[model samples]
Target: MQQKPLTGRLILADVARGLALLTMAIYHFSWDLSWFGVVDWDVSGSPGWRLFAQLIAGSFLFLVGFSLVLAHKSGIRWESFWRREIKVAVAALAVSVATYFIFQDQWVRFGILHSIVVSSLLALPFLRVHYVFALLCGAGVILLYHWLGDYVLPYRQFFWLGLNSLPEVSVDYVPLIPWFGPVLLGIGCGDILHRYDLLRLLRGSASPSVISRCFAWFGRHSLATYLLHQPILFGVVWAGVTAGVLSTNAGDVQVRSFQQSCVMACSQTVDAGVCEQACRCTSSEMMNRGVWEDLLTRPNDADVREIAQQVFQVCLRR
Candidate 1:
């Protein structure tokens, strides 16, 4: 057997990145199922599926930090750094542009890839710092997040600033600020591992046997996988929905279930009651007007804006 090349340093990270990517795919599959009327998106609260998704985001970004440290611990080069930075930055911008076209009503303004790009640049100064310093900075950032999260949500301008407010209209919104705190923590972790050479130890001796090589393969190309999987999943769900295999309207008290789910999911932006009431009201109104299909299959900006306002009014302003 040809001993796998790039197998040493890349080992743990490859596996970790793969697992995170898979988890993210699962989460998005759930979202697509909901979108296609196969199921309701778990928007109810932070209790069940939501917790898993957060864990996935944290893992990926931490890995991003970890990867950065691994990429350049041996040396620093402005040219190489800028080259990698440009690649990531371009991809991030592409994501924003494509999403803006697809979901103009709720396009990702600054999502996970954007975080990775910016956080990588931000992590530069601290790359050579002691783990102790990185730890302290992480703690400070977390504290600041808690202190100011609520205030940031109220100001529309602060949405881009990435604190307090929920991601607007975007399917996946991973902001900076407090979220970056976690990435910083990951950097601290990388520093400790690099300084102590613990990563080598983990690969050689400490890793769980159950993790296996398959999962690691997923980690290696996680970015490409992430980009491709969603469309495939959505296409499947969309076909099912079009074929009437999935029902947009679940009927009777099931509508309440939908409302509850929406309320719980969107409570980050506002209270659950607001979402439930608004969605229920809008759904009911649309049914009465015989325009429920329009709400569900909005093809233009006007329809998106109109239905979004209707949904917003019931959930937010109420």
Candidate 2:
């Protein structure tokens, strides 16, 4: 039998989501700056940036589990559950299609939204299960992935599982593996909260400050914000660059860095002069092919890798 949807929103949860959105924006903005050469480091590839991104993604996924428990605490609301699932699935598809067109080489095939949809579906049975069971399952999943993640799958089709040794070159690539761990943990945590009647207490809590209310508003509309924020941010940055309000030397910087790194690595086996000449030749060829940025930012991209290999061969012969 279908159950009625749960009423009363959790302001604290909304506030948490709102804060996450704010941090996500900051990270994305930094990435945009890195893309525009306003930042000296590779925001997408740097260790600190990568960790920050993971934490943000983890927070969102954790909240997904928590919210699911809160929504279906009494009984499974099949109608509302399916409604939200369908909407999320559609949004995930949109993201995949849009990214495929925009970034053909480094598209997000299964990003955070896609993971959320799958995780939510997989989490259905766990909703009514004991919180400890959910917690153990979550930890098991995480441990399994940690131990076996290095083993490559036989088929490329299963890359979305995050078990393959293939290089990940997407704008966003949140897979099910350990990511589902956070969601399950969230379910366990939410169940604990429900057991202690903390959810009731939270629901009754008021947003005392203006900042809190603003954050709650953002949290409530997070899905809309997520979908719209990147495009708006990218467009604003693009417009500024086009209008000369922002200047960029990212290409030059990338080229110089690539050349220097290449020379340094090559000098280990060859003479310094030969390494310098070869690096220069490779750099020029990369620029001529309009792949200099791709070579640096997406070195593992198929076309970029192929072009680099060919260029290296020619440079070696020269």
Candidate 3:
């Protein structure tokens, strides 16, 4: 089944990808809005929202591969692609550097765009390979992150690799190991579509379904929409706060809940009790300082650890 170019099926993929991008924006807006005294969602110190965000990341990356194959269904064309790759790569690096400038304390050293740029560069080699081989590579990349964890696999250097048991000093680092693997899977899937012309069917080649059209439209311009959605969501959330649509009281229950999430995220260093106690005190002080929400939403590792330590002393006195 050979797929036609830019058919209904392609538009469907866009819509799906667009929805996923929108999901990510929703999460970020929820997070950012919480900071400006808007909606008080437990984004930072909560398991559910964290998982939601991870799912969003995984879907986005997977689709990146999916879309890559669909776009270049003919074959890997470096001459036409390299120029754009450099542009996106530079943009990604600029993001890291610029983010560092903005939030020196908790900068995003390697976020989603960085992963896409790196994966795009690395994926060229595997492009012509058999789809099965590509899938195997994807599996290996994801599994290696865990198999090689205990022996210290150069966190600083491979921080982009995402295979660390103890990741450091970053807000949302999507490393290469596991994350890149998805890109490969997407490519494999893309090739499968290309070989069988399944892309058209998936893109709405078979029948022009409304749902298919929606996702495809999204997939086409995911990059732009993803970049723009956050500011708009933030603005809306900000307005909600200003109009008092959302309350501004994240008190003791919130603190205890926050402590639990922080401990779970950081108890890997043989100091659970310390993290626990300090979290309690930090919560107390932060609440007193009227910055409890701030602590939950956008705190750095130093600040996170500092709070953990402060409460740990309470354990010593006890």
lDDT of 2: 0.81
Q: After superposition on all CA atoms, how large is the RMSD of candidate 3? A: 5.9
Model 2 TM-score, 2 decimals: 0.79
Kindly list the per-residue Cα lDDT of model 1 for residues 35-109, writing each as its tens digit: 544665544233576678778888888887777777765566779889878877787888888888986645677
All candidates: TM-score? 0.74, 0.79, 0.75
List all candidate RMSDs to the true structure. Answer: 6.6, 7.7, 5.9
* Alpha-carbon lDDT, every model: 0.69, 0.81, 0.69
Error of 1 at 261 (Å): 15
Query: Per-residue lDDT tens digits of candidate 2, residues 15-132?
Result: 8899999999988887776676755665754568889999999999999999899888788889999999998899999999999898675678889999999999999899888899
What lDDT would candidate 1 get against the real structure? 0.69
Clashing pairs in 2: none
lDDT of 3 at 153: 52
Q: Which candidate has the top score in lDDT? A: 2
Worst 10 residues of 3 by lDDT: 1-10
Task: Highest TM-score: give the candidate number.
Answer: 2
lDDT of 3 by residue, 1-318 (tens): 444565434556767786887688778877875565445566764679878987898888888787677656566666767876787777677667866885564577888888888888788767677899989998888788667653455355666776444554455668887788889888888888777756656544556567666656665766667656665786776677678886555453466456666565555553444555556565676667676665667666677557645654554355
